[model samples]
Target: MKKTPHASPAAAAFVLAAALLGAAAPAVARDNPVDPVSNPDKLDYRDVEARRPDFKEPFLRDGVVSRPERFREIKPGITQAQVLAVLGQALKQQRGALGTEWDYHFKFQMPQSANYLVCQYKVVFDDSQAVRSAVWRRRQCLDLLPR
Candidate 1:
């Protein structure tokens, strides 16, 4: 009688899994610029600075703390994700049966070392996840709304 080596069930399963994964690996590696698992060093960082609001823009510095004009881009039909892309992130969020709301706080620059003005920007979103409205208000800063 001749004896022959046979793969166990587990060993056969491992080999089949490896073969399938290996076949798909090349296709994934070809198009992706940065591979978190195999080639993380190639990850791009060029957009990191661009995504930040520029300090040179005075409106951004005084109005919303950063990128106040971005608020103007918001419209009734834009989604939550689109709003995030424009506004970076909200300082606080509130959700209710009517819709969701995001708030960002801003501080005013005043003279004579008096207490600075504080303001809040509110953005509301409907159940459909679309922007319903955006507003900024402060009782003290009524004279200098965007200052």
Candidate 2:
């Protein structure tokens, strides 16, 4: 067998440590306080109950399916909130993506773990629509609940 290029253990450890140190870190959310909408008196329950949630807003949730089984390794019918929770962590790490908004078609993928759901969409935009009509994949599932 031909001798492979061998790195000394100390050199390898230093390289690995430096590589990790150089990696981009996720930004933390600011702790500034803001008023909550749940002031109680701010809403009349009777009136609020009569109104429907607006679906036209961007990033507003449409629905969720748990562990949908259409894609390879994704479970079926996972909820929208669950998907968002998983993706949100990844979004913090990646710099290229400005934001993500999705409407689940609920293709019914089954036997998926609590993590990793594929969302299919028509378009993506950044700060401006600089990247428009661009379809892509978003990695989620860091905090996927144990099935």
Candidate 3:
């Protein structure tokens, strides 16, 4: 019978390292565009709004009363997977690996009244598919955040 050839120790190690680095490539490729010194409130929302017409659902137009706590969990530099964990999938947009933005409609219960305020939320991603910034169509909706 013919004997099988085994890889040398150094070759085995090189192959292992390559495999590990390949596995980590996706995470390493994510880009963080947030400027730590700037106000998060100032992020531009127009870019997301420009794509609003792509969605077919009216919920994004009318807004839904979602739990305010979930929105608060989102932060800059997080990966799309993390955002998916916090907010689940975007309401009506099909977010692919190359998609640059995700949109949502959220309404919050007022602090002292029964009225619910409708708001549009947008999350923008860089070409690397990492979270760049998040914005609200109604700036006042930020008040819903817990102090």
Q: For residues 1-147, write the lDDT of model 3, one tens digit per residue.
A: 999999999999999999998987865333333332332544433323425676775443456667877876788788989998888788755453435778777778888999878776778787787887777765467768775
Better of 1 and 3 by lDDT: 3
lDDT of each: 0.59, 0.34, 0.69
Model 3 ranges off by over 4 Å: 1-60, 92-99
Q: Write the per-residue lDDT of candidate 1 for residues 69-114, one digit (tens) a residue.
A: 3556877889989988887688778774346878666665564566
Ranking by lDDT: 3, 1, 2
Query: What's the alpha carbon RMSD for model 1?
Result: 19.1
Question: Where is the poorest 10-residue window by lDDT in model 1?
Answer: 39-48
Relative to the unseen true structure, what is the C-alpha lDDT of residue 70 in candidate 1, on a scale of 0 to 100?
52
Q: Give the TM-score of candidate 2.
A: 0.17
Indicate which candidate wins on TM-score: 3
